[model samples]
Target: MRIGLFPSANYSAKKDIGPMKQMGDSHVISDVLALGKGVAGSQQVLCLDGASILLRKLSLDSISKVEYENNHFCFGVHFLLEGNYSFVSTESKSRLNITSGSYNLVQWPKTNGVEKLKGREYTSIEVFFTQEFLEDLLGTEYNSAFEKFDNTLVDKPKYLWNEMKPIPGRLRLLLLDILHCSYTGIARTNFIESQIRCLLIEVFLGKENGMEQIGGEATLSTLDKEAIDEVVSYIKQNLKRKLTIKELSEVAGFNTTKLKSCFKKVHQTTIFKFITQLRMEKARLLVLEENYTVAQASYEVGYSNPQHFTVAFKKTMGYLPSLLLTNLS
Candidate 1:
């Protein structure tokens, strides 16, 4: 593998490492650069048995516009993994924005983009399969799973507040197992393929619905759609300020209950959850990218309580904002 260290950053790759395996074990893994202006970061990309997983460590200030290669399907499994990234469509440059606070399975469209990485530190797992490889596995029923995965594309997919729940836990363990097997030098086989099938079954069968199901519906008219959009847009724009449902209701000209239901249908989350996530994302951006103090950043994001924000930050990002800032700095 050719490892390139560019003018802005340094990278090193070797076949032997202490805690991780090198990329390309029956799959392809690339060294990803931390993009966006603000903090220095590192990314670990691993090719598990039949899947690819990326672990990225970063400070809060990293947010960059990134482009990915074609022909891969990825599942974002971490807290806010599904919620925050913007996946740009190569064909039309149309973007699919994954809002914060959800789990996601992303299918990369068959298009290419300029190879520059800028954004927050994040790790993602991807499964790449050629048409032939998929056909062999799908036989006659391949389309079914594909359709279900596609349905999720229309909007974000729900995950329980925590992944330890039965359905999500099993899938996560299965993924981790695949990673272990690949790292330990397991050969690709039907057994490995079957495991993937089982994982997909669990994902498609779960009662977890898409963002559209929770946020918006067909019975709602165009005006209703417009109203919901306005309220959501307001919330997004004012993440730094204090916002209440009563305030949002006035903006949308709908009662609190109607507003809440509308948000669930279009965004797949309660208004309160959406705001909490917005605050979390804001705090993350401030502490990691802007280099704000924990106290300063906490308040800027609407967490009047620093202790509460610290706990929430650690819970969502899997690391303390202070620690992340130290690494990036």
Candidate 2:
């Protein structure tokens, strides 16, 4: 049976909690209505009842007055909410210099500077599952399985080293559905269960942990940036050479897994796609500039068979080589 275990809120049966208010020295927002205004510098993860959640950033200095306001979206568990939140820093800096994609947890230190953000819209849906809930799933084998899961997530609080941006359209819709079922008090339907499982798979397996380009932007880590530069130079210098995962990994001096991940982080696509795109672009130029025949260009670009070349070119460029020539002519 599918179930949602989430944070509790201070929102009452009656009375409007209104938009989140900022208070104290830490410029953090909470589901104050449901979770109550946390004591300043509280470290615990507050659980709010029901699933609906919304949060806006607030300045801790003047939160008691509610005078300051800032522009930001309200995104969280079981709801689509957006609004402005504000807090002005008093010590030295007039405004707190938080950038996009910034997040903090109980353990991890907050990463500073705009470079970490890369201008992406920051949003996250925190999902909490109790050990008891997981134990129920494993039944007789629950103990061992639960231990494994716990070990993996033990460092979860600080695991936000990289942001998981949601993909446009498809994945976002999937998240919306999950939140809807969560707050609507609806039973976990079979279809919804599949969707939830799909999300989990994406998180566990998808490149960059299935992070999509929120606002079509990303923040690259230093390791990712270095790996990207190495991979790009290798591809450009050896476009006509046969390429493989191992070779690419070596060129980047990163393990195969890390190379693939860094490629996705910087380029927002896989190495295979990057190489294929480069080859296809070069082939198009050869056809346009040198007037090479499809067969000639195909072999010159490293494809053994003209048919395979045509298939690859069409898949990437959405036009047959001949058609590309026709358009150019």
Candidate 3:
């Protein structure tokens, strides 16, 4: 069924309205609803399982109105990597503006919308999944994770729209991995599916547990917030240095007790875990993108022993660094 705008009888048939065709397991109909002398470039890839794992990058050369319609019931988590766009619901007239480093969730039965893109390049990654797919991955835990939508009737699809929210650091890193993945064919598809499942679990679990508002509370004083930010910056900048909690505490000007508490409050992770996460992420990028060997990447990320780095990388990323290189090759 045609879900988006129908071709108007008045306009000439020479106009381009983007692409409307079957994509993976779903049908996507996108049209240039309105154009102000702009060009749009987009790349879309669907996983082997059809629309189960979809990634899209879009760039607009000028102001334009884009409309999208989907014929299936699925949930989408969109990460606005760059630029901003305004979305107006065609059915409800509700409006939302999504900016970089933020994400929004939308559920089906509510797919039609008009997107107003500013004259700038914008990149976004959207991962879509059906309820059955989520259930298969999450099992009984799914109900608890998505308790907010528990009342949604299966027989009558409901529109669920979650306005933009700040992207958590862990989820951001995963999205980056997906964006930078080098594998192709079935390997790429498998990697994407695994990452999507992890992403979904993290998002829903964060929502369920109120992890989204990590540092947005009056409990953290301004000084404490500043200190936490400083500590985070230091960790990122000094990934090659062996940073202990005591050093980090001094860097933040907070005592050990206060340092741990404030760091957890601000980053939703302990100082050690947070540093390890950053190190692993950096190491992954180095190995994948910079052509760094496992030992070299480990040392670059502050791992004194290559064996330790290998174990830690495997534990956190679910595979050894060498395996990643082999897959890419």
Candidate 4:
């Protein structure tokens, strides 16, 4: 919802023409619709199986704009087909702006924020998944790509990624079909439900086009994600040390089992593997950017035996460490 050229900044939506169509799980609830003075467009919604799909096509007058506050434990994605928006966080004082043809996964536990919109034409689709529904859908899988969501159970909202990504072409077309669905009654409900599942697959597990990581959805609680993130930061800071699972568990305040599961879930790899990855990445940087010798680079990341390090480097990097040295020679 937006506020612009209205009677007052406090203008609340006083009118909801209500239920233009209601059949089975499909409810054509036209809200904030009916081209008013400053704004023009229709806001329709589809609800099914703990998910809500909001489809809006709006056109504002040249001087019109919409400013609305966001306050909820939101876990979903926002797709913008047109217009630009700026979101301001009241708690962190962070600002994010997104242009057309971009989308972002939102796991806002409590976004005490405001979103501003100003454009001649605005179009967007929002898909929201309930915590229970999402968890059920994910089914306790290991190595899910997305991170944690903003949870109502948490005291306050922590870090949420506002990174904007381009909308995949196929997903965009599917969204358009949803916006202009011609099906009615039970068929409409079934169609929308199928589309929702497809949306999830396309955004989070589309191994076909390699868009699985594109949505950047991570599964875990807010606290667990933060704890894991903290552990990762510490690992980065102390890469030269021989970090162990016990030490990381202490750092994360989680037991070994929980720590291992959560870490793998967030990173798509075990803690040890993640550490190896970090070490290999740092060693590569040292060789390529700092011009460190193979031995020096290996030793710098806690590899005492250069031979062992060489084997590991070759296995992880798909090439021998001495090749880098050969290039230098």
Best by TM-score: 3
**CA-lDDT, candidates in order:** 0.50, 0.43, 0.64, 0.64
TM-score of 2: 0.36
Cand. 1 TM to true fold: 0.47
Candidate 3 global Cα RMSD = 7.0
- Each model's Cα RMSD: 10.6, 15.7, 7.0, 16.7
Using lDDT as the measure, which candidate wins?
4
Give residue 253's lDDT in candidate 2 (0 to 100): 81
Each prediction's TM-score versus the true structure: 0.47, 0.36, 0.57, 0.51
lDDT by residue for model 1 (1-329), tens: 21111112111122222323344354433345433356455454544343444544444454544444443332333323322455544456554443433345444433444333334444333344333344455567556545434323322222322211111333444554443233222344334555655555455443444222323233566687679768866887787788998999999999999988877765555777667765766676566557788899888877778899889877755667677565355
Off by over 4 Å in 2: 1-219
lDDT measured at residue 225 in model 1 versus the true structure, 0 to 100: 67
Put down candidate 4 lDDT per residue, 4-42, tens digits, no spaces.
Answer: 111122334444333244434435445543455777777
Task: Tell how far residue 18 is off in model 4, in angstroms.
Answer: 8.6
Local error of candidate 1 at residue 243 (angstroms): 0.8
Q: In candidate 1, what residue range of length 10 has the lowest lDDT sum?
A: 2-11
Give the Cα error of residue 265 in candidate 1, in Å.
Answer: 2.2
